[model samples]
Target: PAAPANSGPLTRPQPVSLGMNAPAGPPTWFVCGAAGAGLGPADSYDVVVRIAHPESVYDLDLYGGTTDPDEAAAILAEALVGDLADPHPGSDSRRSTTVLAQLLGPFKAVHGRFPSVPELRQLLDGAAGPLAALRKALTATGHESLLRELDARERQMGHPGDVGAVLADRIALLDRPAFAGFFDTSGQSRPFSLKALDHPVRVRIDLPERGHADASRILARLVLAQFTASVTVRDDRSLFACLLLDDATGVVTPEAVRAVQRLRSANAGVALTLRTLDDVPRPLRGPLLGATGCRMAFSGLTPWDGQDFAEVWGKEWTEARDVTDRQIIAETPAGKAFTVVRRVITGKAPTARAVTVRQVERERWSASELAHGVPAGHAVLSLTTVKGEHAPPLLVDLRGGPRV
Candidate 1:
């Protein structure tokens, strides 16, 4: 049934609580933005997750504002389907053919300028059989159009001297399989290096589970490769990864994990989101947690999660109890409002650890609750300082014109 006309706007009821054993790996950071702030109409949210360890480092952003829910979902689905089907086993074969064709064009043009027709015929005959037939067809016609066509075809076939040899060299060098082997042997072309780019900033978009996985993966690789290469070649700067994740329920696949791991290994900064701690995948729990040092928790109704947070604070305060306790008394008009106070720890001391756990609550939107045009809920923005000193801006200005 359709929702009632007077029904209130949609809103997340409350966050689910997590247990103490909430995955021991990397910290899984999450954010649930309001409709316009970070979440979009396509049932998507922007997220950023970063992981840094002593041996390895990873930074990734799962959601970029530009990707729509449909597009993202489609990419996810396509990746899954493609992996299962394993289509196009020899797609790289075409690259060799293309390089060969390119080499042929210049070769023919150079040979075509020969002083004698016999020399030209000899050169053509010495080439492939199809090339020789093509030359004959052109000579027999003598028409300017046919000659021009033949010349063009010959040039495309390649330059005269060792054209085939040069093609072989390039094929061995540029072919994907060969290239992979070279990298494997040389150790310079690891999976991390394959996707590395030279960009100061890289924007990544994480799609919802319903979106196309393949398309999203392609889009991400293209954007990252283009930006990284352009920035590196043009500016000679190291590549940086800026990412966003839009998973309402933080269920990610093994492929996603591997892809993200590759990105992080390249020293890219990442940002991602999840609806709750439980939504995080079991396998990814450790790496995700270890990567993200900064965290933000919004309003949650789950008692267990709240209690877990309370315990963290309790441990921090354990040392404070040992210190000299101070007492204070307060008087009220209604009655004797007496209160006892103790010295509160503030720095890196054991007692102060618990104080770091901040209490955050969800915010409500102020616009008309029943307005047809208004977005669902009010957005809450939280910033975490991960690897860098500066945090990216989180603006919520609707009047800034449409986003491309």
Candidate 2:
């Protein structure tokens, strides 16, 4: 049966009959939106989790208090490495990856807890006194490779401490006075892990982007990375998982692009919102666009951004009609008289008209039309199903209500 035509936003809850009906219930909506966005009324949700930022001063665990060392390290590395440049041989990225990978696990095992941002900053500084004790511990454990990575850092620690100093500088930002009590490692603030996605539970993390823009971006990327990782290893593949990032600026990286590609196979999807293609890195712009099954360009999209969508949507075949009017020569006198009479009667030229039709290929939506032709409260969208079915670009009026 169809629902009531004038149903209000508030509706009656599902009734539970005595062992007769089993409602599947609502699925969890894990939202990651900007801080101060006031996503919704607190009473509407079962749980409301807030993050620690400058304005909203609270202690939120950065590491998520995971017992697994590898998971902890991955999250930490995602925060430090902004774009995650290719780790070529002898490159800063490679050295940085090596140092971080070797340091995180051992430090966790030895200290029985993850290191805080300030402690991590000190550990990466080659000149720091703690490195000596860490070295002795690594030596005793026969971690020759880890020791070698540290030695390499020392070698590269010329006037500027190559990768270590670069990474340490990044860690130092969080350690500043403004971020005190945040990113805590003392296990005081209950860490929220993406692993919670395994069950049906609602979670929302509000990022503080106003004053702490860089930290917000770092946290956004970290959450995205963790979400992808969690979805990949879900116990039940039948349950569909989804993540929506309200603002995805500076969150798209090489790893993230790859992760987006694998999401569909895992019965999962991610929706990212960006102001423009410029928000994505130059090289990853194409890959990220390709990875997403659904692409939407709202009104005010620049031609440059529209061009990418136009290319992705490609071209379609359509019929083209051509019409031509030829003046009659009037070879016979009777025909000339009839033509003149008809022309006089109609008050126009007497001519024969010809029509031709042919198949032609054209863009679904041209760049100019997408950029300027899209009206306010409208967007161009294209979609591809997990089974490889496709829907070409469509101009949709967002102001319209959902169709029944």
Candidate 3:
């Protein structure tokens, strides 16, 4: 089955459900959001998710898709089922061996760099030696579950000397053309500082969870570490670096939380966008936000989250009135004499000062107000300056803000 021909302003080569029971033709959909100041939903499943910025570099971590294990395995298998980085495995190149060696952290740690598999093989007595090391490497990396799965795949495809090669092949997808520039690099070392460049370069990595979030999570950390480290060395005002993570869930490491603090002085920042506070892992939330100066929230925060934001935002006082019923009745000039008697009977008379009130304390934006008072197309932004100056939460029209 093919998608209906109506892809109005949509990116092409999108995937449609072409299964047996699927519609003979794919759906024709109307765009829910119009172009201009807003964004629209991408109806189809598969997409490249490009980020192109002229004269500037970007590290984009895109994470979204089905979270099923079976599908994850299948998708990973599909991506990895080719000749990995070493196209010529028989030519005795150091590439595949190096990949396998680094893929196993403990081995790389002990050996300095992974020896060529044949070099490792020459030092070992049995075919099972590398497999034992592989098992130990998996354990050291806290990926023990993968060892069992690796053994099962080995039982299917590997012979006596193929264990290390098979394991390396499982992740060989990274070396493929789809991921060529990103994960499998020739390790170019250069004086590539954004501050030094008269022009900027933009590199966008689209890690859509076509199933297998493990890879995306790994890639996110790698990109974040590189981006943060690159910023550490330079702080040119013109060299602004941003690491953008979309749907950042478990991928946010403690280092990333600290990087938020460290990158600030380097004119760099990390922006993580998740669905809600719940999407943020509890342990890192405090450190993450505590280190960051600015925070912005759209309409979806729950009551508990609103309370947290409200508490941090603190309170402000506004004028309030305490009204006591004491109305002055106008007396005619002829009846002015009875005013003293009326005052005597009433015990008090109305005075010229008819009303008096005092200012009272209240939370600037109450929890409920934050949860509900915010209208569509507006956000509450709390900004703090490097000089430690702070501003209260402001409800701002998103469209009115200057373009980034």
Candidate with the greatest lDDT versus the true structure: 2
Candidate 3 per-residue lDDT over residues 1-404, each given as its tens digit: 00012222121111121112223222211111111211223322212132221221322221112123332222222222221223334222232233232333333343444333233332222256665776677777776556555454346334544434543433442334444333211223111222221223332244534544544554445445545544665534344445445445444555566666886676555555555666555666666667767776666567767776676677888898765665566678745656667788878775545456788889988889877888755668788865679987788765566522
TM-score, candidate number 1: 0.28
lDDT of each: 0.31, 0.68, 0.45
RMSD (Cα, Å) of candidate 2? 6.5
Model 2: weakest 10-residue lDDT segment is: 1-10
User: In terms of TM-score, which candidate is strongest?
Assistant: 2
Give the candidate order by descending lDDT.
2, 3, 1
If both were scored by lDDT, which would come out higher, candidate 1 or candidate 3?
3
Candidate 1 off by > 4 Å: 1-239, 248-251, 254-265, 301-317, 320-404
Candidate 1 per-residue lDDT, tens place, 1-404, comes to 01111111222111111112223222222222221233223222222211111121223221111123332222222222212211332123233233333323333443432112122223333456645665565566554554564465456454544233332332222223211222121122221221233322222232222223333333343233322222223242233433333332322433344445454334443344554545554445555543443332333213433233232222221222223433333356332321212223322222222223334432132112112222332122223443344332122222244321
Return the lDDT, model 2, position 233: 82
Clashing pairs in 2: none
Give candidate 3's whole-model lDDT: 0.45
> Candidate 1 local accuracy as lDDT?
0.31
State the lDDT of candidate 2 residue by residue for 205-317, as single tens digits: 77777777877788788778778877888887665666667778788887789889999898777777776788887788888888988887777878887788888788999
